[model samples]
Target chain A: MESLVLKDISITLGQNLVFDKLSLEFNKKVNTSIIGPGGSGKTTICKILNGDLKYNGSILINGIEIGESNNYLLEKYVGVVLNNSYNKNSLVIDELFAGLDTCNLDYEEEEKRVKKVVKYFKLQDILEKRISSFTIQKKYYIKIIKELIRGCAYIVLDDIFINMDLKEVKRIISYCKQENITIINITSEMEYVLETDNLVVLYNKNVAMVGSTIECLKEEKLLRRLGFNLPFLVDLSIQLGYYGLINKVIIDDRKMIDAIWK
Target chain B: MEIILQDIVCNSTKADKCLNKVNYTFKENSINFCSGLSGRLLRDLLTLKKQRESGYIFVNPNGRLSDIGYVGNNPLKEFTCKTVAEQMLYFKDNYHLKYNNVQEKIKSALLMVGLDESYLSRVITSLSTSELKKVSLACVLFYNPQVLIVDYFEKGLNYKDIEYFKKLFKKLKIKYNRNIIICSDNISNYLDILDEYVIFNNGVLEVKGTNKELYNNVIYKYIEEPHIIKFINLVRKKKGVELDNYIDIKELIKAIYRDVENK
Candidate 1:
C-alpha cells in the first residue's frame, strides 16, 4: 500500500514557529480532511508536499527522503497531485491537458490519457472555450480532471471548494471514492469534514485530534475549541443519535433519514 | 437605490448570451440573493471580466461608479496597500476625507467588520484568507454605498464570521436602509439571513420568491433545500407524517418528539 510520512517536521515563518516537531502519516486509498482554522500550517503542509517549500526533517513516500531529492528526481518519485487553480485567461482545455503532461516524453500516451479523462468528465462541449468563460462548476470539473491526469494515487486539494456548489463538491468526493484516489482536503470548512474517511484536526500549529470520521465527529468539544463552524446536518444528526434516531453520524441527508426510519 | 435589471442580456467574450433578458427589481433596503449567475452575467454584476449587451439597468442615486459597492469573491487581489491601516485610509481618502481623524475612522471601520485594532499594523499580505476577505468587506462597507453587492458571499467565512456578518448586514438593512445584494450558489448557509432569493439558471431568470415558495419549485439548477425541509420531506414521504414547514432543527425535533410521545 502507498503511504506518505512526515517525520519530525518543523518550519519557521517569520517569527512564528508554524510547525514544530509536527509528525503525521497518511495511508493510501483513504480520503482525509485536514480541518483547521486559518494560520494552522495546513496550506504550508500542502506546499511542502508539492515541493514548493523548504522545511526541516524528512518527508517520505515509500520510505524515500523527499526533502533531500532534486526537483528532476523528485518529479518521478513524488506523485501527489497538488491542486493548482487554473489561470482563467491563460488556460483552455487542450492547453491545460498539455500542461499537465509536461513530464511526458510519449506524446501518444499523454493524448490517450487526456482522451480517457475527457470522456470520464463529459467535457465535449466546452473543450475549446477559454476556461474563464465557463461556469464555476465546469471550471472545478476541469481542474479535477487535469489533476487526475497526473496519475497520482495521492491527491491534495488546498481549499479549492470555497466557491463551489455543494452538489458539485459532493460529486467530486464521490468521484474520488469511485476512482480509489487517496484525496486530502486541506480546508477550514466544517461542512467538508463529515464526508471524509478520516479527520485530522489541526489547531495552533499542532495536531489537535486525528481519527476515523466517526471517532472525530464525536469530538464536538475539540471542534468547538478549534473554532470550527459545525455543519447544520452534522450537529442535527449527532443530536438525533443521542436520542436513538441514529446509530452513527451519517453525513448524507437521505442516509441519515433512512437510518432513522429503519 | 432601487436597481432594476430589465432585459439585461450579458454576453461572454465569445459573444454568447449568458443573461437572456433577465428582469428583476432589487428593492431598496432588501436582502436579495442572486444565485447561479452565468460567467458573463456574474462578471457584469460585479463589473469584472465582461460587459452587458442590449439592456436597461436603471438605478437611482447611483450616477457614479462609487455608488455600487461590489466586494468580489476574491477581493484580496484588489488590495494594493502594505498594511490594514493604509488600506483603510486609502478608501477613506477616496471620499475626499481629510487626514485628520482618519485613524479613528479606520479603527471604527475595522471594528465594524469584527477585526481588531491590532490588524492595523499587520501587513496585508500576511493576513489569512478569511481576514483578507473581512478587510475587503470592511473597506467596501466603509464607503457605505447605496447598494452593496457581495459576490460569492460565504466563500471563505466560518460560522462565527458569518454570524458577525449577519448582525452587521441586519444593521445595514434595518437602520441605514441600504440595499444588500448577495450572489452565491448555495442558499443553505444564508437560510436565516436572506430576505428573498432570485435564481439565475444558465442565462435566464428562473424564479424570484421566498425560501418556502422556491423549496418545492425545483426547476432551477442550483437551489439548496434546508436540512429541516429535506428531513420533513423524508418523514412525510416515508412515514406519512404531516409536519408543517419548520425551518429550524429545534422546531423539527419538537414536532418529532411530540409524534413519538403520542405513538
Candidate 2:
C-alpha cells in the first residue's frame, strides 16, 4: 500500500492560489524530492501532509481517510521539520527525549536509537544545549533526524539544507537511506533534488512534472519555462555528451568519468 | 574609506573555531565578497561585528554606518512583524528619520528586488520562500545604510532576482555611494557585482583578489563553466565568436540571439 496519497489537492492562501489540482502519491519505500522555485508550493504540500493546512481534496494515509479521529493516528506515522524557528522556551535535549519517551516505546532501546542517530549527524556535544542558544540550522538538524529515528515511517523536511554545507547534506542523505525511512525533501536546488528516487516538479501553482530524476532532467526546456534551472552537473554532463566525451547525462562526477573512459 | 582586518579570530562553544587569523581589506566604494559556511561566523562578519585587529573601517563622507541589516539564510524567519507594512514601519521607526512614509519605502525596495508593490499589504506569514527572501532584502534596502552587508544574498533567489540585485547594487553604488559586502558559499553568483573576492577556508583567510584576477586564476578551473560558452567554443573552432562571460541564462540567450541575427 502507498504510505500517503493526495487526490486533486487545492490550497489558497489569501487571494493567491498556491496549489491547484495537485495530486501525488508516496510509495511505501521510496524517497521523493519536490523541486521548484520559491513560491512553487513545496512548503504548502508538506504542510498539507502534516495536517497544518486545510485543503480542498482527499488525503489518505495507508488507505485510511484523514479525518479528526484518524489525524492523531496519522501523526504517529509522519514527522515534519518546518523552516521556521523551533520552540525556544528553555527546552533541553534531554527534555525533548523525555517527551518522546511517553510514546510507549522501550526507554533503553529508544535511547540507543537516538544516540545512534545523533552520532550519525554528529550532534553529540550540543545534545544538552538550550534551544535558544542553537542556531536555526542546528535546531532543524536535531529535530528532523531524531523524529525520523523514533519509528516515524515518513519524514518531510522543508529546505533544511539552505544553510548547511555540502558535507552536512551528504550526511543527512546517507542517514535517511540507512534508516530506510521514506523521505520527502523540499528544496530549490536542482543538485540536491536529483539525488532522490523520484522528482516532483511544482510550477505556477500546479504539478508541472513528476517522474524519475533523469526524466525530469530530460525535460530541461520545459522545466526552465516553469522558472527552474537544470542542475549544474547535469548540464555539464549533457554538454560533455555533445562533445562525445560522455554517453549519458547524470549528476554524479564518478559516473560521468567512468562513462567517458569506457 | 577602506575597511581592513588583520589576524581576526572568532569561536563559539558549539564549534571549535570559526574564523582564525583572517586578514583582508575592503576598498572604498567597492563590492567585497566573503564566501564560507552559513553560521554565526558569516553572519557576524557581514554585520561588521566579528573579531578583528587594527584596520580602518571607513564610510563615505555623507554615508552613515549605524544601521545593521541581516538577511538570514531562511528569509522566512528573519521578519517578526505581523504585516508587510508593519515590517517596513519597524525599520523606518528604528533606523531612518529621513523617510517616514512606510508605504513608499516598501514599494521602492520591493521594486528594487523585482517584487510587485501589491504585495506590500500581505501578511508576513503568508509569503513563500522566494517572496520571503525578497521581503527581507526589501527591509534591508529600506534602511538605506551606507555599509550594506547581506548574508547569503543568492540562497533562495532565482536568476531574474539575482540580476535585479546586481543592477540594484550598482545603482546604490552610483547614487548613495554605499559600500556593500555580501557573504555566501557560492562566490561565483556575485562575480559580476563584486569588485573583490575572499574565501574563508578552515577558519583562515585563504585567498583574496579582484573578481577578474580570482576568476582567471582560482575559480574558473574549479567550477564548471557555463554551457553556452562551452557550446560556442565547441561549434566555432577556427573562427570563434567572442562571447562575454555570464553566470546567468538570460545574458547567454541574448548573446545567442544577437549572433543569430547577425548571421
Query: Highest TM-score: which candidate?
Result: 1
DockQ comparisons of all candidates to the true complex: 0.41, 0.25
> Which runs of model 1 end up more than 4 angstroms from their true locations?
A71-85, A89-93, A165-180, A252-255, A258-262, B13-17, B38-51, B62-64, B98-100, B211-214
Alpha carbon lDDT at A118, candidate 2:
69
Across all models, the iRMS values in order are 3.6, 7.6
Q: How many angstroms is residue B113 displaced in model 2 relative to the true structure, after the best TM-score fit?
A: 1.2
Return the clash pairs for model 1, or none.
none
Q: B88-192 in candidate 1: lDDT tens per residue?
A: 777766666445676676777789988888888878766666777888888877666777888775666666677778788889999988888888776766767
Candidate 2, B-chain TM: 0.73
Q: Give residue B242's lDDT in candidate 1 (0 to 100).
A: 86
Q: Which candidate is the best by DockQ?
A: 1
Candidate 2: CAPRI quality band:
acceptable
For every candidate structure, what is the RMSD over all alpha carbons to the true structure, in angstroms? Answer: 3.1, 5.9
Off by over 4 Å in 2: A86-102, A122-138, A240-247, A257-262, B6-23, B36-57, B60-62, B65-69, B74-80, B99-105, B163-167, B170-177, B191-193, B201-204, B212-263
Clashing pairs in 2: none
Candidate 2, Cα interface RMSD: 7.6
